[model samples]
Target: MGVDGSDRGEGAGQLLADGEAQISLRQAEIAAAADALRAGGLVLLPTETVYGLGADAANPAAVAAIFEAKGRPRFNPLIAHVADLETAARIAQLDDRAYALARAFWPGPLTIVAPIRDANAVCDLARAGLDTVAIRVPGHPVSHAVLEAFGGAVVAPSANRSGRPSPTTFADAVAETGDKAAAALDGGPCAVGLESTVVSVLEGQPRLLRPGAVTRVQLQQIVGPLAEADDDAKRSPGRLALHYAPDAPVRINAKAPEAGEAYLAFGGGAGGERVFNLSPTGDLAEAAANLFSFLRAADRTKPSAIAVAPIPEDGLGEAINDRLRRAAGFIG
Candidate 1:
């Protein structure tokens, strides 16, 4: 097929097949994508969660390219993607606790930071010189295949530029990285639209750096009674007060009142407002999946602002609240 006439790149014009998994490629194309990574170019690849803009973590210039491409902040570190536990350990200094956690959650949406033994080998910027690196062993076949072919760790952040919604599909990735990325491997919509949960294991205690598909309770089950960071705790990379927010402001519904706000209810609408039943009948899983997409769509209406109904405080509700609280710009 002819490339699209868009300014994005040579293949920008190819028609996008809808809901089709045949977007799968030949082995040569995959190898070419891997070659791009080894040669210090960016490639947008799929993960079980979201698509990521990837470059060689060991090459500072390549890693910097990711920051530049995404317009990401220097303070916000990137996660290193590996194919397996052995590769993850090779890149980061893992302790026994970290090993135990990895054994339980290595091929899933959990990232752990461990000290870097050879910071020089990896881009100094990749670690932010903290002696630790955030690393994950992805479960997605395409990502694992590419990482294994590349024969080195790839530093990746969400394909979108800083402060934007993450890319869950190839088109979203291309829209974010433009022609700068060599290729974007489309692997269908991401199962989880959010980034991975990040934990710091460099310290003796496992600290929750960022919440993602892996819940705090799940982590505690793997380890034991993980400590929550204090409200006053200094923010780490990706833990900003107003992060993962849409362009429009968000408000949480503390109680059902008579009027004056759009409702994202547990189930059926209360009526007389632009109501979005996040999950009528209180289904948190459905609500979580719909959160970002709904936020994106709601922003289009350009409402004076958005108001969200309250969700339970436990389970996935914690994650929903966490995102909503940030969207509302609550510092505490």
Candidate 2:
């Protein structure tokens, strides 16, 4: 079934007779989807942060298939999604600091890398054969249900192909994975359209690997101040210079341009080559929610360049700036 639950038109209905290809509110349908995942099949499941293409983390072959399906780089590690603390501990070797952070942020948009003895057994591809495995317990009932029902950790990456925008809705997931996924459990749009903030705790000090819904401040409060990723670290995964970018070229400006450039502002602005207000009233949350959607829309114009007004470097604005900077190919 596709992400929308529509049959792939391959007569695979018999394989997923219990609402596999259709949006269903019933628990039985979710269970059926979970059953497919347990059988070493791919399932599109929802997380609070974004939709994920999930497979049993304990199965190396299954984990490798996820990389093959997404065309993701082998060096780019995958996160092990679990139902609870116990499940997360089973996959990764958690320290006291890791445990504290997990207890505080489990079922939320936070991922932590911890040392593992047999990374190959649980998920060789998930850790990329590294000593550490990134693990998290997502705060979505559908994801949790699927993981628990499968009775094991599930290796999940954003439900999109490599180097594409993450999918926030079931429709987007379908557009990304299509008939390849066994089933896409639509739990509704994600609250946080971005990915989880990944913090690596395997080392002596916590390091911020990636930023997302979980802010640096929030993480600081739980764990001590973290070392921001340097140039080398930023080159990893979705943090590449030209990543998370729209089809159009993007430019960032201090003030709204008068003409000749698309005026993307944080507040009021006149329309020109193109106009997109991150927030008409200067609301950061609103801007965050509208960022990707606007980027997707603006890309359709096929403009020569996209100009964006500067946003305050605080709160959600920080995350927005991070994405824009990367999109603009500014690694500095």
When superposed on Cα atoms, how far off is each prediction in RMSD?
Answer: 7.3, 7.4
lDDT of 1 by residue, 1-332 (tens): 01111111111112222211332544676788899998889998887667789999999999888888878878777788887788887777888889987877767677887778657546678876566778887766677668878888888788877876676667767877857798667766665556777777755567887776678887888788776665312324567677666666677754553244455566665544466666776877677766766666666666666778877877767767877887788752
Please list all clashing residue pairs in model 1, or write none if there are none.
3-13, 4-12, 4-13, 266-279, 266-280, 267-280, 267-281
Poorly placed runs, candidate 1 (over 4 Å)? 1-25, 230-236, 254-263, 270-275
Assess candidate 1 and give its lDDT: 0.70
Off by over 4 Å in 2: 1-25, 117-121, 230-237, 257-264, 270-273
TM-score each candidate. Answer: 0.84, 0.84
Candidate 2 residue lDDT tens string, 44-152: 8877667789888878777888888888888887888777788777667888888888877776778887777456546666777666777887766567667767777
Tell me how far the alpha carbon of residue 59 in candidate 1 is from the true structure, in angstroms, after superposition: 1.4
- Checking candidate 2 for backbone clashes, the offending pairs are 5-21, 5-22
